[model samples]
Target: MSVVAVVLTALMFVLLGPVAAHAGAGPRDTGSQPVDSYANAIRQSVWVDTGLDGDRDGKTDRVAADIIRPSEPAAAGRQVPVIMDASPYYSCCGRGNESQVKTYDQSGNPVGFPLYYDNYFVPRGYAVVLVDLAGTDRSDGCVDVGGASDITSAKAVIDWLNGRATAYTTRTGSTTAQAGWSNGSVGMIGKSWDGTVANGVAATGVEGLKTIVDISGISSWYDYYFAQGAALYDGGPDELASEVESSGAQSHCSAEEQALRDGAPRNGDWTSAWQDRDYYANASKVKASVFVAQGMQDLNVRTKNFGQWWNALAANGVQRKIWLSQTGHVDPFDYRRSDWVDTLHQWFDHYLMGVDNGVQSQPMADIERTPDHWSTDPVWPAPGTAATQVGLKASGTNGLGSLSAGAPPASGTERYTDNPAQDEDDWAAQADQATASKVSFTTGTLASDLRLSGGGTVTLTATPTTTSAHLSAVLVDLGPATIRNYEDGAEGITTLNTRSCWGDSTSGDSACYLDTAADTENVQQTVFSRGWADLGHYDPSLHGVSLTPGKPYTITIQLASTDHVVPAGHRLALIVAGTDNGLIVAPSTKPTISVDLSRSSADLPLVGGLPALAHALRGGSGHHHPTATTPAATPSRGPAAALPTSQAARLR
Candidate 1:
């Protein structure tokens, strides 16, 4: 085994020791107080060396941290577990549904911390640490984005909490301090960028990290900025680095910023830099139980981040739970308020306090069916779900087609030219049978509600007129709909003129927050999911294989996972095009492409035996029904065969 692998394996054995015996039990009572009781908590700030000199200052860079803990525990000689949120946005962009930024006193001690974490957890017998990631806020170093420095800086704080590292009241102070009242157990929790740091730190095989709660976070920085060899936006790594770096003299970190850009080129290829940032690549090193909450429609971080990470964790036998929602890029607190707080309390109580709260025996997955409705299941993508391949066949002359159960006839093809100016909505809006920029396929009215419960795959054989092209596949719902207006409420909440209180308040912060109203939009149709691919980079992520012009090549694109119900009479549609104007950078050269109808199909994972019912609904025979003016085309593989209606009904 590789050196890193061997070390990680050894570390896993060390960390996993004895935990299985009391998997769902709480720690022994050491004068532990009730979770609801308030204690007079002390607030302070500290700086720890991360053992890195990104700015070439001849000494290791120091990271800034704001800490709050119950004074009673220290007075009683009791150590408490810590809850840490290390982020770059603590000072600038703020946090939570209200975007509350951290407030400081004249002496540099934190007086007001963003979000409800410190206010709620500190009084409940936990220490809350809000850290300024290296190079951002008051931390001294260059922002390395999601590189080694970023991960290591956060890890150092955990090291200090566990008495393995040194810290000080000031960056260059001679006096030193240690976390004397900490039990050496830490739980990291945050949303978005903060949660992303938690995932990265956990993947470092760090000791004393008991659990992590990642909400709508990215597991792979490469995937966040690129998709199938295409850059998601115009500027690459340097632009992003500059955006997140502290507001100050840019020349201080110019070299570091340039390094980021050089590491992540515009070609969308993975380098060692991206590999270092990918928590999924290092998932084997994670020893903490994970709880993830993400929106299926989160366009910012995207659903693939959570889905792929969850799958990797499962494969590695890591204990985990998830909350999948329909809202776009939203946090569980905004989507499901009361239940979220309660569940979180139980989760932390079990993991950090070792309390046997029966949290482990509960359902592992909670999925949203609508804005206000939810369903619980033992596992995500439910156990009995099966993948059903719905074939695409040419329909009318205007690029419109049909979703068929069987393959198309031997003689049919659809063609379209890449349009850089067209976005996903523009392509989806082409209901007319003759739009030249894209091709669309629609299924017949459903006989019953169809619940698609997992990730989807799109396979197609096509020949591009040019050597390269960008392909975008969209899975859409073809029916009138009213859905959460995630685009407008990018933060997932709108502050109303009213306010309400949830829990007890303190002098520096309040448990009360401005009331938020849900935003919804009505549309004729909605694009449920989409995936993208670049024809040239079909071989591997870092390597590009040049495509031969006019040569047929089969490409498979993995669609984002989702759990949505297509009501009866609603048709499932698939749109194939060369560009998603809003989500990706279009190819510079527009290429004409022809798709082989017989070889193109989409594999959808639906709940129960919906595949059998789909065949029956599309005319008992597994063939396209003949139109009034045209005869039914012959299936390339075989003649149309029929299944017993009784059997189909039974399966349904």
Candidate 2:
């Protein structure tokens, strides 16, 4: 090799380094690369004009966009790809671990961005733009709360980058600002609400957007607030809209806020406004490759968002990758740390910079099997996994039914009354209690490890004693182990005192953040999957039907997607009840439910199907006295006959 080849070869090793097994597509690389002293980068702000006037101010709504770019790429020099994060929380609750808000100088130039995106990517020749969603921060409009204004505001920025929209140097100034430094390749990324906006923007099928990284994002607002016609909150988007509104924009946004309340009523019916906020409806229009990271046990955004979005992306044949963590609502930066930054670096380089770094060829799913232990698979739901139905039989030595494989239970009935006071935590802890409020079915100890790979549904064939019924299903692992305590902690990870830096630092901002570790705990059992449904909404539609009090309805509760393992010697329990208190709103009338044991079953996504489940249920029924880990059978709280009984032979 010549001397020039030697210098270039050495630089490749330095820039690419040894990432988490990510390799570039040979040495014939192109485009701008990372440089030193990247701390001294260009910083500025602009206002993008969205076509919608959500606040009815007689002018187009404008979004606030702050930008930072490397210095080497002069304003009129070689163009570079852009990395953007459009968020509504920049001024309300802030972003990241320390809640770092955007800092600006007197000239309105951005001095700092919330997270490490700008610091790490700017030096790597990518311009990082932080956009404030319309109606929040310095943006002009009412908060739309995942509606047209919320999505179109972010879409306008991508339009500007692609030369389809206009941007002004000042909010009120007529002077225009051009993205001359942009090559029209843009990648969107963020966590939580910010990530959701990225999903919304990509759904628009806009030009210039190359890829998006959505971490713990909601693909649909209806899914976020309602599940199968069951309200997850007492109030809906109106509360959230108020929380993220601009300080002085409440009066301007009052009508919009009232519209949220009207569109999303407490009765759990979907509205046209919700369809406008649902990105999954337009998933077929997405032109950009997608990278999704979600928490399997994410109660806030919930796993169904990713499950639905993933299905849509697959149906559309869109390029995609995923990271399913064993934590709760958290950013990959907080959980995976170094590997997240490394993989993200390669992802942007591949999609945005047009570098074939072999990212697309790698395993599509990176799932955390255990706490802090990750495994990669070519596809999610493990390729060979299949849906298997397990019957609930009332034949166990314990009072609960036995989950057996074969034909559905032929001739048994189990009844449970509605109890809105006891939640999943209370139910899981009292599994042996013979309370009429809840019923449970348990599988024998697994002789071998049985893995559940994807999403499934707990379908019940039953009759309700009242006109309306709200039901909940819980899948629990009856074994002691340490697990991420995402049930209590909202973020699912705790920040430590120690700090780690990722890129070059400036006077106003540093690339460093407090290190985080999984918030874990030793538990007797872990509730891995849960689903809720309203019996009145048996068709799984937004509207509820008025059913006769004693009519049997086929209700399918779609389980939240998960990747969990039932270890050999551990038992699996399925708890059936009504109204997950504190989690979702209860029905107006708490009615007792009667389920046909032989007809009801949980359709599970088992990695090995019947053979794997059979092997796990081996070893002579695996029933005996409670082990050191299993909770001993407790006393019953109330007699089973205490529930209301009707002439239809159903318990109420």
Candidate 3:
């Protein structure tokens, strides 16, 4: 052969030799591809048309997507699954541990990507796609704020990946683009707003969506901004929509912004607009298995969001896994660190790559007991737990009362005036027996550790002086202790200047992140869980019932779900008040409320026997063994037998 022919043959051997050797290799056989090698990789951006004119511009809106994948598999005629994260904050707020945003070159192609997903998964033989939701980043249209456009925009990308939708090289549809390397199986993962998009898309029952990992995500947009018809935040949907959209002339999307405001009215009631954004209502359409993680103490997204969504998924028989924590809005990376990476690696391996790693066989739920401490259980709330009602009785001349197993006092009532200015701390700081703005009820030091595994209900049979008033119920743990101050930061992580590396780094991305330490605070008492309801919205949401001048109403407030251990010597207290200044938009008029001691009680979910506790309380005994059957009620006077037989029967 001639020298030129020999040289061409050598070049062919160099390119085809490696591909021939690993022709039959699958993701399961090789685990993840080597991290350092990217000789066979593809990085590009595409615009997916969502088939919607969100801003009424007479043209369809397009979603912006930046993709990074192992080109070796494609070059060798192999198809790979995808791991996608659809986020609206990519341009404005960024994402992940260090809040890194996507950087583009002068030609408008992505040069720098945020977070560790691309760096970690791209080398693992999986394609990673980071998408900018429509109306944010480089995408077209207006921010609909979790409406039809918001959800469909992301779903279109999944369709395109599966070869069911159209995509283009430019927003104006200059040239066609296709996901030729994709195998049609996609797993979506994200935190907060990004995760919300994942949930919304999954609810659409998109064909190619195999699974989703939603972290600190909202299931209902209405719940995020309001609580039982009470506004929890300053701005409504309109303000938030305008805030998250790409920074530009406000007049461009003024009409769309006004529509969002009109949809979410100032009264904070559920409207048709909210119904379109409620993922919980449409969870039955989900075909994908779900992995959820949320902080039990997260006041931002709130625990109710996860609890309701989980319940809906369970009712619909959707496969699911959960991680419940005591920290506030946080990512698992900052909370569990190394373990998160390993578990996530396994999770993606199993769901996206079809690897049988026994992840599905493990416990369904993992709960954080305290900072850095965790326990795994087969199910949340531990399955066999029962609801036990603890009676509230008039204790002393002071307004404070007692929480006990026995019945409440007959014909006695405690009164309080609504105070909109008092926050949680202010309410807890006031002398329990002297506060007129709230009524406090406390149990004596516990003889044994009492564990509360689920949400609690505070039922109040009371009469309000006004037509409408907001009620706030709080469960407090009164004891000196050190606890994670989740209110301070995500997972209570205090960011330090020092950096720590967690994974392999690339030219466009770094695996190192700023070191973070748990933020712990010493305190005498902490609010375990809280609930709020506008008195007018007692019957159902959006439908308010006017109160008669002196008529009594039975209002049941469902507190935020939680898993906590009220340790030995710690007192469990329940506080009843009007308006949580820090959480709710209080009613304008201050109303006087009278709670009947004989009728009102707090229902708690306890793991132990309730009758035995009641028997012990009645007999004035300390730490008696619980009986399997219900204890017979003994005839007594005062508060011991003050609970009406009919009411007690209703409780049972």
- Determine which window of 10 residues in candidate 2 has minimal summed lDDT: 643-652
Top lDDT: which candidate number? Answer: 2
Selected candidate, larger TM-score, 1 vs 2: 2
Candidate 2 lDDT over residue span 556-630, tens digit each: 899988888888878888899998876677998989898887678888889989888887887735432242133
The ten-residue window of minimal lDDT in model 1 covers: 636-645
Against the hidden true structure, what lDDT does model 1 obtain? 0.75
lDDT of 1 by residue, 502-591 (tens): 555677777777766566667666777888888776655545566788998788887887777777767677889997776777886789
List candidate 3 stretches off by more than 4 Å. 1-30, 33-40, 406-411, 429-432, 489-491, 545-549, 609-652
Please tell me which predicted candidate would have the highest TM-score against the true structure.
Answer: 2
Write down the lDDT of every candidate, Cα atoms only: 0.75, 0.80, 0.76
Give one digit per residue, the lDDT tens place, for model 3 in 1-652. 9999999999987766544333224533434545324434677899998998877779888889998888777766778889999887787766876768898778887767787777677767778889987788888888887888789878999999999989999878679899888999899999887788889999999999999999988898878887777677667767767666886414578888888888888676778998998999999999999999887877777777887888899899998999887777778877777777777877887777777567777788898877788998887666766788888877654457777874545558988889776766555544244566787777766766777777778888888998878888888877777877765534466777988775556676776888767778787777878888877776765656667757888878888778777777776778899987767877867899998878888888776648634533442322211222222322211111211222111111
The residue pairs that clash in candidate 3, if any, are 40-71
What shift in Å separates residue 636 of candidate 3 from its native position after superposition? 42
Model 1, runs deviating above 4 Å: 1-39, 247-249, 396-398, 406-411, 545-547, 609-652
